[model samples]
Every structure is written in structure tokens, then in C-alpha cells.
Target: MASRSFAEEDFSCPVCCDIFINPVLLSCSHSFCSSCIQRVWRNKTLKECPVCRTTSSNDHPPVNLALRNLCESFQQERKPKSGPGVCSVHNETIKLFCLDDQQPVCVVCRDSRKHTNHRFCPVDEAVADNKEILKASLERLQEELRRSVNREQKLCKTAGDIKVHAQDTETQIKDEFKELRQFLDDEEAARITALREEEEKRSQRMKEKIEETSKQISSLTITIRDIEEQMKTEDVSFLQNVKATLQRFVFVSVLLNSNHHS
Candidate 1:
């Protein structure tokens, strides 16, 4: 059995939504009309796939020769036969367009009872006028596409900028925290050093005071022992030395008072 013929959609270009014309293939495996892709990329900075939105590395993609040949063959196969342009009712060549019916009719059909009050114009003239209207419509659509592409580009750029800003802000925060940490560490070290110095100074002063107090205690102990020894002496000898002993006792009392004050 013969295989079924390929559908029209197989030869269609995604960009033009029509039969491929001079199709070009991107590295991403998508194909579009060369003119259509060029027009899409004309006002853009980066080249991208229209359907998938994939970024393309190549500015000028290679021609899809196999696809282009298929498109050409499909167009040839769908072309209207020459005799089909004749009107079936009048069996005449269709040269006029019925404005009311909006269909092509032969010269005889233009005056038929069915089209008595219908407006008519030459097929060529009507085709030209309609072509102009279609051209205008196509231009409007293209303009709308350009605007949409511009908006997409702006949105993409904004997203990239936002990402960059977030990264920079994060880096800045980390740096600031690092500096703060360093400052805190330095302050802590400085306070600890000051405390240690103060401790050393106070410890030395305490040691000196203890040594002086110890020397005073030793002197008082010697004076006490001498007094006790003199108390054991005979009463007559003790009476004779009592004046000198009293003077010595008065001197020792003064020393004790001074040590107490210090």
C-alpha cells in the first residue's frame, strides 16, 4: 500500500504560521523562515528561538535545505489546476467579482437573475484592493509583534539587573558583618588587656603593703620581748632604769601609732 502524504502542517514555519520560505535551522533544532527570523531579530540584541525561547549562539543560522525542498514540493502539489478557474454555472472564465456574494463569477453570471442587483468589479481590481487591505493588516500585526518583543527584552533585562543587585547586596552585608566582627574582637582584646594590666598593678601594690605590714609586726614583737625582759629585773635596778625604759616605751608607742595610721 502507498504511504499517506504528509500534512500541510509538516511544511509550515512556526514564525510565519505558513509554508516555509527559505527555511533556516537554529542549533536548537527549530526551523523558521529566514526572512521571518531576521525580522524578529532585527531590533533585538540577542538571537533566540521563537517557539522555545532558547538563546541562540549563532547569529546567522544554517539553511534547512531538506525542509525547504519539502516546502517547495508541498506548495507545488497544492497549486490550483488551470481549468479550475472557470465558472461551473456559466462554463466561462471567471473575470468578475460579486461584491454582494463575495465570490468570483464569470462575465455571464454577472448579469444573471441571481446577481441582478449585485455590485461587480473586475477580479484583478478586487484582488488588488483586497491585497492592499491585507498588507495593512499584516503591517499592524508586525508592529504589535515588535512592541511585544521590546517588552519581553525589557523584562528580561530587569530580571537580570535584580539578580545582580541581590548578589551585590549580599556581598556588601557579608563584608559589613565581617568588619563588625573584627571590631568587636579588637574591642574585646583591648578590654582584656586593660583588665590584666590593672590586675598586675593592684597585685604588686598589695604585695608591697603586705611586706611593709609584716616588717612592722616584726618590730612590734621585738619591742614587746624587750619590755617583758625588763619587767623581770630587780625592783631597785628596775626603778633606776624606769625613766630610760619609759622613754623607750614612749618611742615604741609612737612607732605603733604610725604603723596603724599607715
Candidate 2:
């Protein structure tokens, strides 16, 4: 009795304050009844160990088979009474489960008219079958979840690629515009240089033409003065000067006509 008491104290689940039922092991090596742990963490966002408060990294922790076996062995040694779990209606031990009604029923209820044409199974068998169905469903849900995550990742990568492509296109456009602007600037500089050179050439030609016209005017004035001084002298001197003055006048008339044509 003393050993049994000690074992009960050691094996009792912390959450339920009872012997472990379907114990599961966490990463921290702590053990608890599956139902008790689920209840503690139910509707919670973060999964954590109830005893140590350590966060669990795994979505589903493994079952503690050794601990479960120990709990079963301990219960068997304790020799639980059959009457405590008996059906109140039939006054018999509940050994079978009603598949249609989804409840436990005694042998009398199984044969009764209320359960007519209904499927039935032993309690242990029903538990095992239900567990299998639940496990298969869980696997299907997990597969769907994994597919959703993969799709999300692919979409993110595609979006990133599109952004990078857009940036590259923008840079190319800017570079092309820069080249165009530089070409325009260089063309403007060349045109301005050509215009300045043409202006300088035109100005130099005008200066040369002005100097030549001034020299022609000075020569004409000197010829006129010589003719006037000779006219004041005697008739023979005036006649000799008249021939030179006529030649000078003809030369000045030809120069003025040439200048007008130019």
C-alpha cells in the first residue's frame, strides 16, 4: 500500500490532478495526460508546456508510450471497481458503444428496440477506430496547409521578381534619356561654334572693304587739288593739267562703278 501510494503520487498528472490518461511527451521531457494538456492549451495561440511553461516548437508532440504503459499497469494493479462505471438505466456495466447514437450503452441497451438496426462496437474498439479516423483527417489537413504555404512562397518570389524588373526598366529609361540629352547638348555647341565663326568672317570682310574705300577716296581728293592749282595758272599749263585731270576723273568714275556693282 505504501509503494502504491508513492507510485500514485509520482504518476498523477499535474493538469488533471489524476493518473495520466493518454500521456504525451513534450520537448522538455515533461509528461501530461493528452486530454488535460489539450484543455490547458485550448483556444490558445501559442503552444506551451503547462508544467514548466516552456514553449513547444512542434505542432504535435509524441505520445509517451512507456509512461502510458506504466499508467495502465498501475491501474490494473489497483483493481478498479466495475460498478462505478455501470449504466444507470440498465444497471449493467457499459461494455459496448452505440455507433448511431454516439454514446456508451450496456448489453441490454444494445438489444433494446431503441437501438434497433444500429451498429455497435466494444468500447476499446470504438476508441481505436475513432482515433484512426481522426489521425487520417489530421494528415489530410496538414497536407493542404503545406500546399497553401508553398503557393504563398511562390507568389512572394514572383512579386519580388516583378519589382526588380520594374526597377531595371526605369534605370534603362533614365539612361536612354541621359544619352539623348547629351547628344542634344553636343549638337547645340557645334551649331553655336559654326555661327560664331561665320560672324567673325563676315566682320573681317567688312573691315577690309572699309579700308580700301578710304584709300580710294584719299587718292581722288589729291588729284582734284592738283587740277584746281593748275587751272589758276596760264592757259598752256591749264591744258597740260587738263589731260592728266581727265585721266584721273575717268579712273575715279570706273572705281565708283565697280564699287557699286560689288
Candidate 3:
């Protein structure tokens, strides 16, 4: 019964102001009872719809089989339920609905001065119209939600891409600096090795020169001792060794000069 109450309004036709009987679909997608529409056309000069000024292209519109089936289902659910089914304000049956204030009214309330100029519709018609508006709003809200989700997803993807690119750039920079540092280290090592090799060569040459000079000094000292000993032997011994001693002295002096120039 509750389902029927909620859905019963959707099956009502605007014409005849009641539930549809053999509902037909117009080109404008509005549904009306076939018999009701035919009667409306019977006395009309222009073949236009009563709700909208749209002209009817076909005299007999196609039957709204889907709507008919839905109406049938609603009717099956409309079994009587236990209720007083009367208005508390006027103690009358709640039949009419106030369109202006969106409230149900009894016949006495409908005739009241408060609703004198207000538009009125059957309870079912009002319910159906309100339901359609609600359905449209629901669809719009769902579309908006979908768009928001898509926007969020796009932003998330972009953020992820930015992070990835940043990491890649950071890695590349590290790799480039690492290569530069390695090159500098290799260059420094090569320079240090060259310096060491040069120093060793110079030191080795200096040592060899010092050893040669020491050998020359030792030989000169021995020659000087022999000459001195010969001098003490008298004029005959001195003459015999003098030539060899002078020759050795001359050779030592020449070697000393050569070492000083080098």
C-alpha cells in the first residue's frame, strides 16, 4: 500500500484528472489516456496538445505499453489498508492537493479563502509531478558527482606524474655529479702520481751523484796519504812516486769540477 501510494500518482493522466486508461504517448513524450485525448481532439479545431501548444503530427499516437504495464503493477499494489482516511482539520476526506503550499487539503480547505486563488491538483498528480522533479534533481546531482570524481582522478594522476618526474630529475642530477666527482678524483690521482714519479727520479739522481762524489773524495784522500809517506822517504823515493801521485791528483780534480757543474 505504501509503494502504491508513492507510485500511484505517476500513473495518473493530466486529462480526465485521474489514473490513465489505455495511455498513449505523444511526440512530446507526454502520456494521456487514449479515450481522453480522442475526446479532447473531437471538439478542437487545431490538432494541438492541451498541455503544450505543440501540434500533433499523428492523429492516433502509439500506445505507451510500458507506462500501462507500470500502472497495472501500481494498481496491484493498491489493495486497501486500514486507516481513517480523513483530514484532521476539516474532518473530511483528503482528496485535493494545494499546489502553491505543497499540502494536502480537504474539500472544505480547498474552498477556504486561503486557497481561493491557489492552483489545485489531485493528490496523485501532485505527487507524480514532485517525484519527476526529484528524479531530475537526483540525475543532475549524480552527474555532478561523477564529474567531481573525474576531476579528482585527473589531479591525482598529474600529481603522481610530477613526483615521478622529480625523482627522475633528481636521479639524473646525482648520476651527473657522481661522474664529475669521479673524473676529478681520477685527474687528481694522475697529477699526484706524476708528481711522486718526478720527485723520486730527482732524489735518485741526487743520491747517485752524492755516492760518486764520496768515492772520488775517498780515492783522493788515499792518494794524498801515499804522497805524504813518499815525501818522508827522502829525495830518491820522492822522485820515483811523484809522477804517479801528480797524475792521480789531476784526475781527482777534474772529476770534482765535473760534479760541481752537474
What TM-score does candidate 3 get on C-alpha atoms? Answer: 0.35
- Cα lDDT over the full model 2: 0.64
**Which parts of model 1 are misplaced by more than 4 Å?**
1-84, 112-116, 179-262
TM-score of each: 0.34, 0.33, 0.35
* Residue lDDT tens for model 1, 149-197: 5544565565555556655655665565566775576765565566556
Query: Which residue pairs show collisions in model 3?
Result: none
* Backbone atom clashes (below 3 Å) for every candidate: 0, 0, 0
The alpha-carbon root-mean-square deviation between model 2 and the true structure, to one decimal in Å, is 51.1
Worst 10 residues of 2 by lDDT: 234-243
Each prediction's Cα lDDT score? 0.65, 0.64, 0.63
The total number of steric clashes, by the backbone 3 Å criterion, in model 2 comes to 0
Residues 6-99, candidate 2: write the lDDT tens digits. 5576777887666788999999999988887888888998889987889998767889998888777776655543343465444577778777
lDDT of 2 at 45: 88
Is candidate 1 or 3 superior in TM-score? 3
The weakest ten consecutive residues by lDDT in model 3 span 234-243
